[model samples]
Target chain A: MDEETAKMIADKGAWLCLQPFLDDEDAIPFPEGTPQRTKQLAMVAGTENAYRLAKKHNIKTAFGTDVLFDAELAAKQGKQLAKLQRWYTPFEVLKMATFNNAQLLKFCGPRDPYPGELGVIKEGALADMILVDGNPLQNLDLIIDPTKNFVLIMKDGKIYKNTIQFK
Target chain B: MLFLYGLLGRAQETAEKNTILIINATVFDGQNEKMQEGMSILVEGNKIAKIAKTINIPQTAQVVNAQGKVLMPGLIDAHAHPMFAGISQQAGLTSQDGYLNLVAAKTAEKFLMQGFTSLREASGNSISLKCAIDQGLYLGPRIYPTGPMISQTSGHADYRPSTSIPYDPNATLSYIERSGHALIADGVPEIIKGVRSVLRMGATQVKLGAGGGVASIYDPLDVTQYTFEELKAAVDVAETWNTYVMVHAYTPKAIQTSLGPG
Candidate 1:
């Protein structure tokens, strides 16, 4: 498609979901030079290209990690987002994961299960939120360990967790 | 002394209201370039009522001084398999459904505590687990279940014993297959039926084993599993139901074959 068309869709909030960590060398446990490993390398290159193109065209982007099979690896999802810092600023990565992804979910139309607004802190928005102990924009590494960094979690306006006393 | 006690009683009465006010928080707002500090957020009945540098606190609102904590939106996992529960493949064959469900329940809560508010189930037996959480029978993230992974005989999802004959009416399903975790289907018609069965079981998406897997006992890493016709049939059924099909494939050829002309 033309740049003009790309910009038009981006302006309306089209999202390009990027998962750089999926292509990391450690992602595939196969031996080096194996067909599976080589394929993973190609996949990584493809992902990098897609990221470059999205950035060049100013397409709206979102963070994603297609982690499956291993629960241990899946728990490290935050690290996947931090890996994006290699090609993007921490602030940009954070925004893509939150606001941009939220906008993308709106494309689900009537199939969207959560009807209320999400991915932001504003009046009338759904209160599905988290409280981090440290500023992630300044130190994205803090997000890598949710247990230590995330002090509180609130979903649907109900407090699921609160480490600090709040009476 | 009597007037002071009465005033204290009134204050306690106000605190009983369900409103919460969080102040002195370094709010991320999930979209802003810079973190806004010393902000106050008002939560009323499960929705953000107001957010500003200063908010009027009601007499009954429970106020929390955040001490400059970073506040942002809850995280999301686009691909997850909460039902897998880290159990060994051999153990999976022997474990009872009730035991497996319990493990899934624990796994789901752990995900929520880790700040994942929502997840998309990649495969496994997650339909009932999703229902349990949605119905308030258990605590978990908002799940988008795929039900089971569909595979051709000896494909990536095939966890059957090597001796088990394919498409034998007299033979019973393997424990993994009998557990609603996966389906072994071959040919275009079987693939279509498999896709439709999952859709009927509350699946929002379909997962097809379109390539060889490292864990498969029979298929090699380079082999493509389902034919284009079989893949197309699965996709067509998914499309008819307003959903999409996701395939498990790694190599270039396997991935290309899945995407070919379908």
Candidate 2:
């Protein structure tokens, strides 16, 4: 259906199932070398190409994280890929996974001088928060490591995985 | 054999008489380094055939200088947004079709001048433009392009609200090509089929917007648009055809939602 129809469906409070890129007829083919390779190196590499698509389409995107399934899985594969490639930083990778995404989602609140109370450790408002052993504000991977930096409990939320502590 | 010799002789006569022995120039051979300074590099037939510390040069071999300039393999950006002479800035308003070919032509050249020997244009409906550059019809960098991005309605790529005025309804379709971007499909089957169509048209990589855009009117940016199964289905189809998917998202929810099981 055209965009108007889709919007109409959405306006009525219906969920719209979305598709991915590469599915567009307008997508340009990958260049000449390795033309035969099936794997999408650009996506896995998290190259600027993926970022450009996100920019142009105004869509939120990560290197290959969006296409990958699990957060931990994305981190694992992303790390492995970066390691084999030998030129990626884990911090940058984590940033792409967290804050960059937060920016796209407009989640962390406004751009004002620290909505200081927004993501702060307060009680009444968003009791739902994550408490990690190691500082995730510095390294994103720590958020995932149950051993390195275990997650406590969801203050006022449902927990999918059990909470654990290190020390 | 005679034809080959004749070709070589003709080449030898017209070619510059510079038998340059690049001694110890650092060469980044993609994988590793073979750094040996004293080795002499021979230049014959436009190719480096041998490297010896001491070698007898043909009387016609002209020795030149290579004091500096490390010979590391050229770097690759893998991605870029090239701009041209007049169309560098994409902010202002202009006739859409008027400069279509021109922008395509110049952007390709800009990519080359910037030393990006090969590049991947993330998204655009410019396949023919890419073909023109590929066939040497124009001067530009080698480009692998994804013609356009696929997004859902009122989704990250939906440009309706932004393009619309407080009083204009017809403005809807006007911005479809620009903001709604290209093929915005629904559900798993349609998504799969859409990807196949792009593949048929020469797409080397697939791109998708799995959540609301950074600037959406209805839902929050982090609001998930496609379910994990949906994205996985798209990825599966792409993989079957020898391609992969790239999703557009910013929020952790969007990222975590769109990408699954790695």
Worst lDDT run of 10 residues, candidate 1 chain B, spans B85-94
Q: Each candidate: fraction of true contacts kept?
A: 0.50, 0.00
Query: Can you tell me which runs of candidate 1 are displaced by over 4 Å?
Result: A1-75, A100-109, B1-18, B256-262
Docking class of 1: acceptable
Model 1: lDDT of residue A103: 68
Clashing pairs in 1: B14-B60
> TM-scores of the models, in the given order?
0.78, 0.48
How well does candidate 2 score on lDDT at residue B179?
26
> Please, what are the lDDT tens digits per residue for candidate 1 over residues A1-167?
23443454355444445567454543735468765566555556556655666687787766666654455665677887788887888888777777766665554334456678777888898888889888888899988888888888888776778887865
What is the C-alpha DockQ of each candidate? 0.35, 0.02
